[model samples]
Target: MKGLVGNMGIAHLRYPTAGSSANSEAQPFYVNSPYGVVLAHNGNLVNAEKLKVHLDQDVHRHINTDSDSELLLNVFAAELEKKGKVRVNDEDIFTALEGVYKLCVGGYACVGMLAGYSLIGFRDPHGIRPLVFGTRTKADGAKDYMLSSESVVLKAQGFTEWRDILPGEAVIIPKDTMTPVFKQVTQPLSYSPDIFEYVYFARPDSVIDGISVYRSHLAMGDMLAENIAKRFGGRETLSDFIDVVIPVPDTARNAALQCAVNLDLPYREGFVKNRYIGRTFIMPNQKERKSSVRRKLNAMGLEFKGKNVLLVDDSIVRGTTSKEIVQMAREAGAKKVYFASCAPAIRYNHIYGIDLADTRALVGYGRNNQEIADVIGADDVIYQELDDLVKSVLASGNNDKITGFEVGVFTGEYITGVEAGYFKHLENLREYNARFKQNSILAGDDPKAEVDIGIYNEGDY
Candidate 1:
């Protein structure tokens, strides 16, 4: 730890999508050639497999791991080497980054250090992810620059001036200097940012792409209340039908409070969440997720007994947690449980970064509201309308130049074009993984008996 001294340093926390969670898959991948570059990435690359092939055959670079971040580092390094310069400068970095943008497809927000020279940050052309830039001035007349995935980090660090990095743009902050040079390296393919960031991932206080996460949740609650009223008559009927409105836990608190207020229904903390337990949606597998849901939340019998209760969650990806919570409420003596999702139904895979990757895994995919409600054991399931979600999230009417947030999961319109053969590849991979999982389960159940395995590993199957 003592050896970590540097004029500038960058760090990252990654949730793996393309690769397994081995120690070798960690980020801030370094490439020490031409001019050394250390980089960390935030989003998934849709064209990573294709890029890996190009890197091997054309770029002549060897990738050690399956991580897209490693491939990205090699791509950036090759760009710098193309200049054939002993020492690299901002122009070389900019030119190299432009090449990287052209070669890569899918969401990315990256920050890196150019050896001992500069700190660099860039966002994908589509701006599918977020990147914010902040600057702080010291009494000694020196300025410091920072870039992060969200603005909350800058605010926490007491940065006085901050703004978002535009799509298709790159910024370079030279070492030991406060001044930052900015350039637009590529034309934006589309300005569609991920709406799920505001819906689920980002901190409540964060402002992503000019929308307040907390306020967005409030608007979602308002819209949800509106939808409930339209579907089930007035507050007089709702008050009798739903005795109390309860949030799933911390993330749904804002929406729950506002929903209760708008519906004229009582609001209570029905579930006491154990914060130490990680979010089940991000859990590695179904086994871990199921176990964690039980550990994470406990129902209050007093709140549920003899009363029809309404439960609210930010979104339902797999529905495992939702089903468990509904069963818990029933066990607690609740007369009936009505579940509402603040976000629209996730009917398509999120190729960007939110981890609802498999179509078959999504509970709402190819299912109606009644079918979904039955599957989750809710009396009725309610989801925010896609149009209403878009309106609520972009409530302030700011950023008129931009159209709206990416609604791929709800509308099935991929803002960035989906490749021709990608879906088939994903399905094949899913089938292989399913076989591997089945084989492992069978082996665990009967160790002494010989089992016929169709295919052994992940890819071979």
Candidate 2:
């Protein structure tokens, strides 16, 4: 199976940790005291500190890593062993995980049972990241259920049909049984972008919760070009200007194409990424991650030198990679380097999947445009406005779907400064409280929504 699926074929239960990038951090980390457990997990636990405290003090188990996913696996596995005893069934294990965690903190993930016969899955109360599943018919005429971070994996393996798993819902995948059962964990908080999905995490041809990531990105690319050109108004010269184009890296490829078509400028590739380092998670320290970006992207100095280069990126969370690439472009003798992000100010921390840590760690958090500009070292930095952000993605009929984050957050205009600071408290709420916030944030006409009616159909998908 490992040979068949390569990376995707490896499961939480059976895979080994040797020769892996994160060997100590590998999945299916085992425990002996808790009924000989093995675990693999996705997502972060908001209350991980508290859970750790409880686990050490009460359960007498000491945690070894900083990952909330591992901590969560330990806690839940302990709970299962304690409650299930020797004869505990899959139903009992699922029920045990309920009230103990009202919030999975800020992540969406799945856990496979190593000692038991069931695979358990859960999402953050809000559908932050995406999880897709489908049933595949084997050559033997058997239908097998599969779950993954994206449907692209299924398609790559020749499984064309798939559907998204709803947020806050837990589905039980039985090992020997043909049928799967679901138990709603809690109501979904509200939908937020997995953060990474739009920028650098997911594959290009992926869909999350019914929205096409590719289409959403094309809008971002086009909007980014408009915003950047609008900001760098001084570059009106015919020759000094390199015109609108993408650098051929992951962040700006789609948007660059759209930017070129929209601006009627000749689009060309400026930088080529070494595909070897595809996508990796954003870590806490910006200093440590900058070198990795160079290992991933090399500037086409010949193409960009003496050109007023416009660099379009998906987002600039820590701005480390963007800073390096811009410096590389400038050192290569580019006339000027302009930077623009498809995302608006990512000023707040993502409690959802992006695994982006606290706002205090973000280069853009609490800082205005000027500070962010200096940090990223761009000649100019332009971001899509929050209102334009929603318009670019959600369009018309899809306006009210994101119940967790307020539409007002996307627009960046809070009507009041007090309301503007609301996201600081978003990470601390429980599932029920988070749901309440999503339900209460809106009550008026969102005059800004311009959903694309063409994307909405009555029935056939």
Candidate 3:
């Protein structure tokens, strides 16, 4: 391993948001094209089917996999091939990327090696996902630039100066030059970085698009606190309604603290999290998610024995986990249970890169506050408002760079345009997979059964 050598190399983790877990579908997907490119991307192409057709018919290229990242790589390759150069410079790369921005839709933050030529990176025009850039100087005083989906990596790796690569911006490091050049390939359009990154996806220590993720989470708590207060009169009346503020654990801790502070309630660790359990939200199927949820947290009966507990979570997607937690609270002898969400209701599918493809599976879909509370077995439910989410994040700083965020799941208006029938396509896929998942759960069989239309998982395609 120590003997491995290259001018530059890229490593990527495929989270399966838009592809299968097969080894063949893993990324840093390599392509022998205009200059021989190896590309890795963190996003899902909403128009991948259309792009595949275009690539085959218009560009005369073939996509070997159903992975959207592969389609994006081929698109980039085809565009570069159009430049009629075996080896190209930054200008050619940006021109080719402009073609990508025009034809492809949904979120993408891409990084790649242009063979022996250059290291290239770019983000979608709307910045639905995140990419941060950093620079460091070697002992000899030559500078090296790094790009990643999170800033914590750059910080951990000793990069001196780091910042977000803006939406529609491209950074190129030519093999010969070694100096990284930044180019705005597309117009400086309105940016709508995904709000969920701040809420769930990113590490709390990270900073995305110039906003500190930890602070954003804390601010979300602050907003949740404010909303909670308004729902139950002023802060003075909160204690009468709620005895203690509790977090679902890990992600919701910061927000829970803020909620407790604003409402003048005692903050308590009412639920003991089993750190060994993986996140239920990212699990592939309903059975895994439900099983993980049941095993992931244990109620502290001492805390909930006679208290009215208000539980805070980053978001409520399916509500299955919330119901389990609420039942745990009840079993622990709690007089009442209240649930609060730092994010608004998730009612629509996210075409960007998240695996939440079925609107029907969302607990908050078509349900009002009281209805959501009823479904989750909570005495009351509170969710952060859309405007407050924007305000809280903006207040953290960088009001100039990020004027707003993509609340597409909550608002159902994709920042990037979606073609007609896209929702229908997603629903059909999710329904097909849901049947298989349901059968697996009922039979207590292996959960990885395949559906008929499965090029991959329901959300990926």
Root-mean-square deviation of every model: 5.1, 13.6, 4.4
Question: Residue 453: error of model 2 in Å?
Answer: 55
Which pairs of residues clash in candidate 3, taking residues 3 or more apart in a chain or in different chains? none
Instruction: Please give, for residues 356-439, the per-residue lDDT of candidate 1 as tens digits.
Output: 658888998999999999999999999999888888888943766466677888878887777667666555544444454455
Q: Which lDDT value does model 2 have at 64?
A: 56
Task: By TM-score, rank the candidates, best first.
Answer: 1, 3, 2
- Superior candidate under TM-score, 1 versus 2: 1
TM-score of each: 0.92, 0.75, 0.91
For 1-461, candidate 3 gives per-residue lDDT tens digits of 46779758888975656555556667788877677889999987888778877987799776655578889999888888888965687888889999989888889999999878889989998888888889998999998888999989998989979878888999998889888899999985678889988888888988888888889888898888988888989877778988898899889888789778877789999888899998787677767787888799998899999988899999998888888889999999999999999999898887788777478778888899999999989999999999998888887766486757888889888887787776766664454445554553444322342332222322332
Model 3 regions more than 4 Å off: 1-3, 428-461
Q: How close is candidate 3 to the true structure, as a TM-score?
A: 0.91
| C-alpha-based local distance difference test score of model 1 | 0.84
lDDT of 2: 0.60
List candidate 1 segments past 4 Å from native. 1-3, 424-461
Clashes within 3 Å, all models in order: 0, 10, 0
